[model samples]
Target: MSIPTGDVPIGATVLALAEGATLTPVWANEIGGFTFRAQRADGTTRYIKYGPHNAEVSMFDEAERLSWANQYLRVPVVVQVGADHTHEWLVTEAIDGASAVDPRWIAEPRTAVTAIGRGLRRLHDALPVSECAWLWDPYSRIAGAEARGLTVPDRLRTPPSDDVLVVCHGDACAPNTLLDDAGNPIAHVDFGALGLGDRWSDIAVASMSTEWNYGPGYEDLLIEAYGVEPDRDRLAYYRDLWNAT
Candidate 1:
């Protein structure tokens, strides 16, 4: 996913959702989904995410995850979730921070990486795994991918033993973290895949994302900020699993 540029046509459904609120396109995903910030005249702000039907990403799932996560974390407040014959939309009250991959944070990798680490730890420690109704283990992920008709390597079938399991933020990439002015991570977004799984499922992805967002040499920094010595075995296994599935 990336920040949108140039003209991004607003769909009729999204326009209707805005209800006269001024709309600003904020994000565009690789799968053709778009997230817009809707600023109403009364000073309230809401976000509208719209996309064509895609099994991999579901706005309805995201809305449910956000609702469940909000009981323990700072997630967007759901306003509405609906889908048309060919598309889906989710409207949520805007959160109060910028994404970690925001240009300002991109220029300050040290702070961004550190915050991402701490924030991830907080997420793991805060969300109750036993209460979670979703699963993101390798078996589930592999099965889901296969159901989508994607080929999976046999090597990925036997994943490493579970290290500590936590409610993982399935897409723990840099862009999913939100940070405040002090560079402290305050919230996380994109929870369509959030579920019970090994903590490394998130750790490996979050650390690996550092290279894509802020270059190399910062992987360990994020791991360090999470307050644990790197488990190379688990890290490698999950990173590979992420790429394959």
Candidate 2:
């Protein structure tokens, strides 16, 4: 299920990166990237994501992260990865459901929101931070921001605390959670920035994206579904950190 954004052209040579498959353009992102759904003659379905190398959105990095995260969670399986001088692309096996922000789910915000929160909680609880290799702690994150030539504001520079940490999804927005036809979250996608961090790093962004993808008045339902009381300080700080970094 691809949402049409009229930014990039419908097709390109990158679509032919995989042999013996017919690719249909499905999605295009702001970072000059495109996602194509491919159907091979054998009835196998796969997704191909391509973007400029200079865009700083690395399919190579995502492929590595997915390989590591797959040991602990339900995510897309990496099929192949390739790169040229100007661009890089990743091919992955399709997961079983549509994004949480799919049209049907958007119309039913409660179901969508609840599944997102629960799905995120399941992801955090399932993946042990001690076993993960990457780090998404405040220092690492702020350093990443600076490396990208972005300035971190003083308020967002200081994170709440590391007393509680989990394997943060890195990009825990509503659209990243894949929901089944019954609106149950079946899997998660997009692990380019996945790492060990404070649970609020995921919680705050997942809740904030509820407002961005669905309409207002749904953030509380998400928190409730996650079975946690609101930590206002962490929520405020991580959200600011989210927008900044």
Candidate 3:
């Protein structure tokens, strides 16, 4: 189904009733969904996200997870939730930060990479695993993708030899990391895939994004900031698995 990429119908309903509110969609991704920054007439801003057809489960799960984590993590506040868990939308308080893809970060890749690394480490260190109940395990995702008939690139379909695990952001792409005016990471978004998994799952996937978004010579910096040498074998293994599933 074609993904919706602008002001959500639900968001429109909310704004129409809200005094002097205007909604502007700021970001949209293929597999995920669209995010709208709602500027209320009161000068207050909130964010609303709606997914492509059949993405309600992911959207709703993300909202619930975000709501639970808001107690501890400096994450967005989920203000409103849809009635049904399916065919739904999520609303959150607007966060003050720019995405890593923002022009500022595009020009300052080193600082942006460092911020991502530090932010990720903080998440890994601070979030108490005992309280969370989810598994973003790659093995399950592979099976789900297959069931959905989504083509898993042959390159991304293998199991890794290393299995040291940690709580991961799951989808740690450049766009998910939010930076402040000073280029420090303030918050993270896109938690649909957040869960307990191998540390390599996060490291490999994030480092690999450098190739797609930032070009060469930056992967090493990410590894350095991650405070570990590149695990080439694990990197190759998970990347191929990610592509496939």
Q: For each candidate, what is the lDDT?
A: 0.94, 0.84, 0.72
Who wins the TM-score comparison? 1
Q: Which tens-of-lDDT digit does each residue in 1-245 have in candidate 3? A: 12245444544444543335676667666655566777876778888776554522366778777877777688888787664433356788888898877777888899988888777777777677777787767677776777878777655555664466677778887778899999888899877777777778787777778767777878778778878887888888777766665
Clashes of 3: 8
| Cα deviation of 198, candidate 3, in Å | 0.3
Q: Candidate 3: which stretches are off by over 4 Å?
A: 1-20, 55-57, 83-86, 151-158, 161-163
Clash pairs, candidate 1, are: none
TM-score order of candidates, top first: 1, 2, 3
The digit string of per-residue lDDT tens for model 1 on 78-188 reads 999999899999999988899999899999999999999999999999999989999999999999988888899998899888889999999999999999999999999
Winner by lDDT between candidate 3 and candidate 2 = 2
RMSD of each: 0.9, 2.0, 3.5
TM-score of each predicted structure versus truth: 0.98, 0.93, 0.85
Q: Whose lDDT is greatest here?
A: 1
Would you list the rank order by lDDT, best first? 1, 2, 3
Q: Which ten contiguous residues of candidate 3 have the minimum total lDDT? A: 1-10
Pick by lDDT: 1 or 2, better one: 1
Which stretches of candidate 2 lie above 4 Å from their native place? Answer: 6-12, 54-57
Candidate 2 structure quality by residue, lDDT tens digits, 1-245: 24655555644556466576877777777667788888888888899888778433478878998998889889999999888887788999998799898789989999999999999999988888788888877788888888889999987766677747888889898989999898888889988888989888888889998988897999888988987998988888888887787
